[model samples]
Target: MDSVSEAQFELDQLRHQARKQLLGTVVLGVMAGLLAFVGQSALGQARPLLESSFGTWQSLYTVVLWALAIAWLVALIQQALHYQNISEQFESRRRLDAVYAERAAKAQAVEEERQRQRAESEARQAAERNRRLNKNSHSTKFDFWQE
Candidate 1:
């Protein structure tokens, strides 16, 4: 409900998202590497066929390896971008907290000042009323301590 809590929740969400993305990148990278290894061996076994079909097994293997390398790089970039997102969210939350705290503090100070002024005014009025009453009483010769 509060701004502070909302910001914290958003920050936590971003952190979780970034972690998931990073984990996905690692898994994908490992998978790509494994595929490359298997592909190279298969290419070796089918050397004659590959050469006859596309000129050379080495060519086929190289092309496949390059493709896999590209995929891996893409995944790595995604992971880095996710990390950046998390950092940006964290910084944003920090700024929000600081701004909110400042506003609350200023409001409290203003309220206290207002209360102090009101109390002082009330005290001054009470004293003025007492002076007026005393003057009237003396003129009337009131409170002679008579029975």
Candidate 2:
């Protein structure tokens, strides 16, 4: 349709994308928290095992815990970066929305001014026509007073 309609549609799409990104960020944060809790529990359990006998199973358990911690850290970093990206997208959308709003307002103002000018021109034409009719009728011979 028009530019304003297109801009509004695009803005709506951006809003939807922003919402999905926010949801993804939240999911990542939750995953990171879960991983952290699991890692903490593993570490707490490992303390007792370490105090007892230092076995192969204990070594493998520690390695697994380290991997979980690493995964948690990666998830946290990803969430932070995703959040930053979302913020930038929202800012860009906001600017674009403002521009579209201004453009729509300007277009509306221009249309109103054009309509006002048209009305004024029609009024002037009608007034001129009425004046001509009045002048001709007054000069007509059919008017007994004039004769």
Candidate 3:
């Protein structure tokens, strides 16, 4: 509705988004680690099975291992980049929140000053009215005696 509420709502949304991004990054990292471990285990088990054949099979097995290693490296790099992006997003949100807080504080201070000035103006007006009333009443009393 108002600017303050709107700012607060936006800040909340940013926080939610940042949390979600963090969770996603963690999940990605875990998945990458699992993939590497599983791939390594599978290759280790397969090596003995092909050992009897040797020669050509050994070359193929080496190629397969290298490919898997490369894939794992790529996955790790991708996850790291995703995490970096998320970190940047968090930083941006933090800066935005700081700006919002500063603006809110300034707005509150301005509103308080405005209220104080208004109260002082009202007090001055009330005092002026009372002074005029007293002067008129004293003059009227003298007039009553003359009549």
Candidate 4:
């Protein structure tokens, strides 16, 4: 495919991937919250185990989640900017095409008008020449037959 089609395809893929990531992130966030709630209340006997695990890993897990979230945000921003650039390029190209088309039409109209004026001038000159020739012929020996 052409470059335009390729870029469009890539944009579409990115859009789909972004959507999936967003949904997955939301669902995972909800599940994590629910798990935390259940563990805090319903599983009292497991508090020591959970607390130890949390103490050992919660900070690290939080950092990792934040990093992933930031990366996703950056990807989304890049995608939006890229899409905007492509849209601007298309808009400028359309405007340029319109300007070129208008110029061509104007040139064609001017050329046609010029040709019409030239034709009219030539016709008037031919008529004037014929009139002179007829007048001169009548006053010359060429008119003997008429006399």
Candidate 5:
């Protein structure tokens, strides 16, 4: 379509993309939290079963838990960074949209002012024409009366 419509479409797309990114970041964060919780719960439950098998399984379990915790922390940090990036993008888009809206408002105001001036000019012209017509008619009537 027109440039205005295209710009609007692009703005809408940006908004949608930002929203999706935010949602994905939230989902990732939630998943990471859930994973940590579940891991802890499972480890606690399995501790009883491993009591008899102690040493070997205990070391393995500790290593595994530490690895998972490290991984979860990393993932959480990554997701937080991604969310911040999305927020920055969203803010940028909003600023752009605000600029566009301000420009549009100024353009509309200029157009309206021009239209008002044009209408006033036309009215003045019409009034001047009417005055001239009245003067001519009065002159003709006076000449006829003198005859």
Candidate 6:
């Protein structure tokens, strides 16, 4: 492959890895959030309508909810960094795969060339042997038996 194609392939590999990782994180986070919305302790969600909501310790719960939002943001950033790392690894793998393919193709071409030359040489040698045999027989075939 040319340099341009190689570069494009590498770029694609990186993007694909990053996208996949991000997608996985988003799915998990949303699922967890859903669990919390249903009052699951680990999955507790912020009350949808906190505005003017009257209850004891309401301010405390609101603060806790905001803190959770901040934590989620941090988690997202961390996941992004992790996915970037994964992308780098995937890009390296793609490059290695390309190199291996190139080497294999070159080896196959060399073998084919060798096979072609060998066939041509064998054809030439057989033709020469037939020519010599015919030449000898043409001058030595006049013997008859007498009783």
Pick the lDDT winner. 1
Model 5 off-target regions past 4 Å? 1-53, 140-147
Q: Which sequence of candidate numbers ranks them by TM-score, best first? A: 1, 3, 5, 2, 4, 6
**Candidate 4 lDDT, 1-147, residue by residue in tens:** 645555556666665665666566666666656666574454456556778676446555556657766766666566666656666655565566667668979999999999999999999999999999987766666666776
Q: In model 2, which range of ten residues has the least summed lDDT?
A: 52-61
For model 2 the TM-score comes to 0.60
Sequence-dependent TM-score of model 6: 0.54
TM-score of 3: 0.65
lDDT of 6 by residue, 1-107 (tens): 76646766777776777777678777867875675455434223334444345343455655666677677767778879877776776667677777878998999
Candidate 3 segments exceeding 4 Å error: 1-52, 140-142, 145-147
- Candidate 2, superposed: residue stretches over 4 Å from native: 1-58, 140-147
For model 5, state the Cα shift of residue 26 in Å.
9.5
| 2 or 3, greater by lDDT | 2
Give the poorly placed runs of model 1, Cα more than 4 Å off. Answer: 3-8, 38-58, 138-147
Q: Report the lDDT of model 1 for residue 117.
A: 100
Clashing pairs in 5: none
- Each prediction's TM-score against the native? 0.70, 0.60, 0.65, 0.57, 0.64, 0.54
Q: Cα RMSD (Å) per model?
A: 4.0, 5.3, 5.1, 6.6, 5.0, 9.0
- 2 or 5, which is superior by lDDT? 5
Query: Would you give me the overall lDDT of model 6?
Result: 0.70
Q: How are the candidates ranked when ordered by lDDT, highest leading?
A: 1, 5, 2, 3, 6, 4
Tens digits of per-residue lDDT, candidate 1, 48-144, equal 6766675565776788789878877987887888788888878888888889889999999999999999999999999999999887667444456
Error of 6 at 91 (Å): 2.2
Weakest ten-residue segment in model 3 by summed lDDT: 2-11
**Global lDDT of model 1:** 0.82
Pairs of colliding residues, candidate 4: none
The per-model lDDT (C-alpha) reads 0.82, 0.72, 0.71, 0.67, 0.73, 0.70
